[model samples]
Target chain A: MSTQLTTLLAVFLFPGGLFALVLGLSLKGLDRRVAARLQGRIGPPLAQPFFDLVKLGFKRTMVPATASQPVFLGAPLVGVVSMLVAVALVPVSGLYSPDPMLGNLIVLLYLLMVPAIVLMIAGSASTSPYGALGFSREMTLMLAYEAPIVLAVLAVALRTGMGQGGVITFSLTDIIAYQRSHGMFLLDPVMWPALAAFALFFPANLGIIPFDIPEAETEVLEGPLLEYSGPALGLFKVMSALKAVVVLSLGIALFMPLPFDGIWGLVGWLVQLAVLMEIGVTVVRLSMGRMRIDQAFGFFLKWPLLLAIASVVTVTIVA
Target chain B: MTDHTVACSYKIPVGPLHVALEEPMYFRVAVKGETIETVELNAGHVHRGVEYLATKRTLLQNMILTERICSLCSNSHPEALAMAAETIGAVEVPERAQYLRVIAGEVKRVASHLFNVGILAHLVGYEALFMHAMQVREVAQDLKEAVYGNRMDLGAHCLGGTRCDMDDEAITYMRSALDKLEPDVRELEKTYRTNGSILRRTRGIGILSHADAIACGVVGPVARASGIQYDVRTAAPYHVYDRLPVNVPVLDGCDVWSRAMIRLSEAVNSIEILRVCLDQLPEGPINDGGDPYIPPGQAIARTEAPRGELVYYLKTNDNPEPERLKWRVPSYPNWDALTFMLKEAKVADIAIIVNSIDPCISCTER
Candidate 1:
């Protein structure tokens, strides 16, 4: 009973619901501020995203007459809920490990795909032309990026499992433990391909500039999210913010879970998140242009796919 | 057609309120599964009847009214209109005024070209490149504001001369600003030329072949990108362009990248022209300030606006107010060519192709 209570506390409080939400929003805020500064303009306040959320809450949620009322209202909720659980699944090095009963890396992988699926469903349900266009692009992009991500995860799982005298392990705890004792996969030359593949995966998964073809605001009018308004839109924002935490934390666990313990580990993890967000999300998005759905599809199939496959092969032979 | 056949194709209406466009122009796109088959455009959402309004105002008032037609090419309208009025009235603009007009026009071209390219980066999803381009463009913006007291519409051109004159300090400021902008623009040119991602998104995406461009009567960067060597500055030398050595950058790639490259190269040329104008600026009165009356006559004046050739026609009957005022903006010629560019484009390329022409719906509609 106490374990159940602790699990509930973990899901709703630290490292999950509230904490991840705040951290994610703050990171997004920082990204905007830094992007503005780089552009030589005064950006919004650090709390601007949060204020936007509060302001969104006060506005009315207008449903398009043609939209499927249930899916239109329910998509963001499902997305937000999925991300909340996914955040809890991400083990924070020495500071916190997800309850094994909650899930593992495999479950987290499926959970991570929920938001994109939700976006697709929301778009289709909206019945708007742009939303329909977004749905098609989102599906194509998902098909493109998913292969590399699965391969990248498999590469890491194989590396950890092989070192521990097994064929494979999907447990996040085992992956972190292997990295902690044997030094980070980030520093290992053989794991560099997997690391690179993983690095490519997050920006696409997070829908940053280059791979943001599905939600290309200028093209399809933000595609699926065009029809959403008020709290429904805010919920999508929450889902994305929480998603950034889950995906970033998952990357750290897979490649470079820090060796520190307790409070220090948590602080170190936060610092790492900030650095990764800055370099991967902020800087990459700032510099690059968005590729068309076909171009992005071809890109993923070419480079990251090859890299992920190479990483898997290298891990198998090396281990 | 059978019901099954009808089911295969669907029409998607983009914009009357779409995010991709800055102004309201609806495009009814027929698609057969993500590939655009046909595009039908419906414009005039931003029409303010500026041509009709111009006839209501006096020659002086029409100069200001024409400037309001399109903010991006705001100065071009007034400058062209002023030239038309001057030609009809047989007014000889002072040598210094001619140089100053070139300076204003070139500076505006630089800012306008930079803005179009920056927006291209934005449409392509290169936020950093877009921001950097805009930041570089701010240098030109500052120069305009400092010289003409307005960032967008300089309001400097008049029938006989210019309303604003550049002092030595302003000239020095313009030189320094150009100095600061040159390296950054050069770096941007390199990035656009070499960046694989940008190349993939832009190259071969929206091809407006040289033949198609010529047949459609496309102008400015769109024509230049398609290997058309026609530039109003060189072809029909207006004002001090005869004194200046105008090198028009023509590319045969005829794609979005070529369009972008043309704008960048043209920006560099505009900077050089500005330097020459500053050096050759003669000492004289800025304007005649003679009789405000324009005798009964009709005259046409054309200048190379940032987008393309801007033509203004003026007719007067020995009165303060003109009988008729008309303009032929570059975007008008280029709008019809979108059908050719978007013929076989993917749905994703729709916005990029539309923006590639840098279509000014306001100017076109006006």
Candidate 2:
């Protein structure tokens, strides 16, 4: 209701959402550029993603005969909107988000899950066998990565609370405020392990490799995205890119809180945030190969899950 | 969630057309409880009758045709065809030509391996690795262009010798390029070996034992990954390989990961071989052999391609064109092994594992 909240919401919705969408695509382009250099060939242009989106956007979209229309139609829209909501919740270049409470740790986590759910619903709606196969794989991936992600969130929450003289706070603003008073990077050293856990989670949560089994190109053909075309696929891609921004931003927000507290101080904070996200993604991706769905699941069940559990314990201990 | 739905098993199909690998293939998988019961591969979608088309094209023309088989394994086809032609012609190519051939071939091997590494990254959704791999490969491309004047089809080989000559400037360029690549390839190899995600995904999945590889008739990296020490370069001694000291990496795992590792190791080895060839290269004419002949009898020649052993069978009838040419590319044997590789691997590995063979579907179908 306040003008500040309204302004913050506007910034998050347009710039934050757009920044993520564009940044994610740019990440893909940068990936191509890096790959080209490695192969000893000059690869496609850095704006290749922009061109691809334009091409896919103009392509035809035909629903399969066996598809369920509502789920099919609603899935991509929901994917985009949910990502938009996540963007809305995360403070990008500002002090707080619009309806800042929605930026509560739990709500942000739930919003992150919505895109995957919508993807499954849409994938199932297509009724294509590949779609079904991809959807199932996506579900497995969802289960695999979710625990680590939740634990990552819990680690940040507990670290913030423990560092703030034993006050437990779930609010992003509160976490930021705590960090503003007491430097964020100086939270519980146990939070270092938790941060490490989150670092791993960022890739899986965004479905990047070594954890991208569900959408393995050879096996699933974009997984839940096999049947999507034209604007629908475009929207899905945009949402994915935005989701990258959101997840990375969320990671940045949790551990590397802003040095500046005021809204005007956000420019420097956002730049630092972008660089951190880029470096994190670049390092992890370059260093790892992809995991098979089963292997990925096995991994989640073993180490990442343990890490997550450890974080929760760390939260309890630190809190 | 229904018992009835769970009780009855159904068939699901995925792609003869999709964006996993650049090539398209179909699969009909039967799943009974989220576990795949059976997987049936449907190839031939991308088959453009390359073999049948080979029957129509002349031997010299087919060199270009063969290079088009796959973007990654671009140099293997021309090398095989040229070797086959040499066997039929009974011509001993100049030593310098032999050295040049080996250098060019090894350069391509490094480039091809890097490309496969990128695809492996792409498959696992490791965009960063994919990009880095490709970036490193570009140095090889530059060398290719500098040496042969074309990145993809170097147009180097005729029957007895190559079309392009490597001058001092080109040699200098190659030296500098390898210097840049040495560190990059090492770092990339380390990442593959140590990264938990990649190591987890590739280490044990799609394991093909030594027996399975021999039974399936796998060749090249696929066979080597299963601990087979059969490299055509060392075993058969093609070109200058008999003269040069080459170490073929043999991993005993026989799994998808091993195959990937073998390629990485080979890339480094190829770089070493190139440096040796460069140091020892004798100064002579690139192509001093007389004009190529269309022999009356058939001749079989084999070379160690980047993938593995590539066998070329040529039947010339004393005409400008060859009567018949049959190429036993590494992929023909490797593709047969795919049935075994994919049998146990979770479906997600199909792309990378298929890519690990560097499956030149164009070469296979051709």
Candidate 3:
């Protein structure tokens, strides 16, 4: 409505949106590097993911004759939009709109599911056997990992506790501010284990190695992406990379405990966040082999799940 | 006579251009509601008429030809053919060459398992673990480079035995590499076995009954996973596998999970084999022969490739070039099991299960 509002929206929506897109895609590149290093080879550069996205974006799109057109076109866009929403929530700089709470932890959590749900619908819409197959995997993965992720987030929420300023807010900014003031990661005794829990669960969230069954290229070509191509495919590729960044940012926001409010601190924190995410992913990827689908479920169901529950209960008891 | 009846059958053409398995293959699945009635495999996707080309190249030139057969099992193809050449001419290989051949074969085995298991993990949605496994596997790739002098086409194998020998420094470097991979491999094995979601999807998904496995002529881990217990390494040990004892892990489940577990266990066994070979460090020349080209005759050589029993049949007339060369890759037999495996496998398991066999399409088609 106002020129000032328009300028502010441009900063967050344009640069912030582009930053999320670029950084998110950068995660994919980071993932490639980390994966390569872990596998004992020199992996691709940080720019490798961008190249892949451009390559996939420019490639011709093929759709099965029997598939529904809307679902095919809509799936990848949903992936991009949801990630964009997630990025908008991340406190990149001190600048904030009237309702910064829109990017809060709870909203981010709810939004995270949109891309995956969209993918499931797309997979179901496509008549291809691989699409249907990938759809089943995506559903199964959501069911298995969603609880652990929620539990991990809850653990972070517990560690930060509630501020004395007002009614307890689940806003990410509030959580970061609380940590920044009280030596962040230093609050909850269970923070280290919670961070570890995030480490184990994050790969599944990003669909990087060890948790990339839904789009197993060797087996299913590209999973939910079986039939997508051109711009639509690029969006999915970009969204995945973006999702990687969002997950890493969430990890940093809750765990890194750095003061990202200052300009220089924000840049330093972002770089550190990027490097940490890349190193975490790379070390894990190259060091291990894949788990079977059932085995992956088993892993989530076991120690990670238990730790999540334990962290929540511990926080509750301590409070 | 049994009537050839298309009774209540539907044709589901898979591949030559589709997902679930790489290297173009088409399976016309005739099914009666998930019960597969018959399977017709069309395998001409990657058939480059390599057998025809064998006549045009000299024995030495064919070495590179054999390597290109399968990008994954590049070393195994040429190694088997070279072994056949040695047998045809009754050539005596140097002791050092024998050790080197065993080293190369075992190292490739480790690397191939890493590659396959990584794919299996990737297919199942464990991207991080897949990358980790492959990253650790790079140690084997590095070792391949250090010992054989190349990563993919090691150029190590020859008619007599091998073209490469390890010096003390190189042997020490290789020993350290094995040492580095041991812990990582152990950690991966622990994670895969305990990881619940992985077990859920893979366990009992593709139950290849022992009877089905035998009838299908399944080789390598596919058969072994089904309780067939037929590892060419133990049954007919070649290239020093006879001297060393290897406990073949056989699980009766015969599903995708079992095959995957079998690969993991074999990877462990391969590391042990490499360690032992490196420690032994026998002394001799790299080769003990005249020209490696064999005299006129037909010879069949067999070796335990990463996938399974890879056999190479070579027919050499007096010409410097062989008349014909046929590489019987393990995937050929294993791919046939797909029709049976895919029957009622909830479509999602199709790709992951197919990848568990580590099908080398290039080698099979070549």
Best by TM-score: 1
**Cα TM-score of candidate 1:** 0.96
> Candidate 2: which stretches are off by over 4 Å?
A1-60, A79-109, A144-203, A209-213, A216-219, A237-262, A265-276, A279-287, A298-319, B1-4, B7-15, B31-36, B46-89, B279-295
Measured with C-alpha atoms, the lDDT of residue B127 in candidate 1 is 78
Model 3 lDDT tens row, B1-366: 999884464554557776446567776655443344566778777878898898899877888788887776788888888888889888887767777888888888888888888777766656566667788888889988887788888888776777776788888898889989988888878877888657866888878899999999999989989898888878988777777757788989888888888888888998898888777658778776557657899989998888888988988898999998877889989988887787766444556766877888887777
| Structure candidate 1, residue pairs in collision | none
Q: How do all models score by TM-score?
A: 0.96, 0.81, 0.69
Q: Give DockQ for candidates 1 onward, in order.
A: 0.77, 0.48, 0.21
Candidate structures ordered by DockQ, highest first? 1, 2, 3
When 1 and 3 are scored with DockQ, the better candidate is 1
Q: What tens-digit string does per-residue lDDT give for candidate 3 at A1-319?
A: 8755654563346434676677666766766676666555687887987887778767887777898887778777777777776766665333332246344788889878877887788777777656665677777777788887888888777656544344345767667767767776645575666766777778787775677767667555666777777777788777776677677777877776565555676577668766877676765554444554655777788878887888777666655
The 10-residue segment of model 3 chain B with minimum total lDDT is: B29-38
Q: Per-residue alpha-carbon lDDT of model 2 for A1-319, expressed as tens digits?
A: 8766664555454545665677678866776676556444588898898898999888988787888877797788888877877776765434654455445778889999988888788878988666777777788888887888787777777777777766566788767676667776436476766777777777777776666655656567766787788888888888787787688778767877666656655666656655755566655555566666666678777887788788778777755
Ranking by TM-score: 1, 2, 3
Q: What are the iRMS values of all candidates?
A: 1.2, 3.5, 5.5
Tell me the docking grade of candidate 1.
Answer: medium
lDDT of 2 by residue, B198-253 (tens): 77667776778799888988888889999889998899888889888789889998
> What local lDDT score does residue A182 receive in model 2, on the 0 to 100 scale?
74
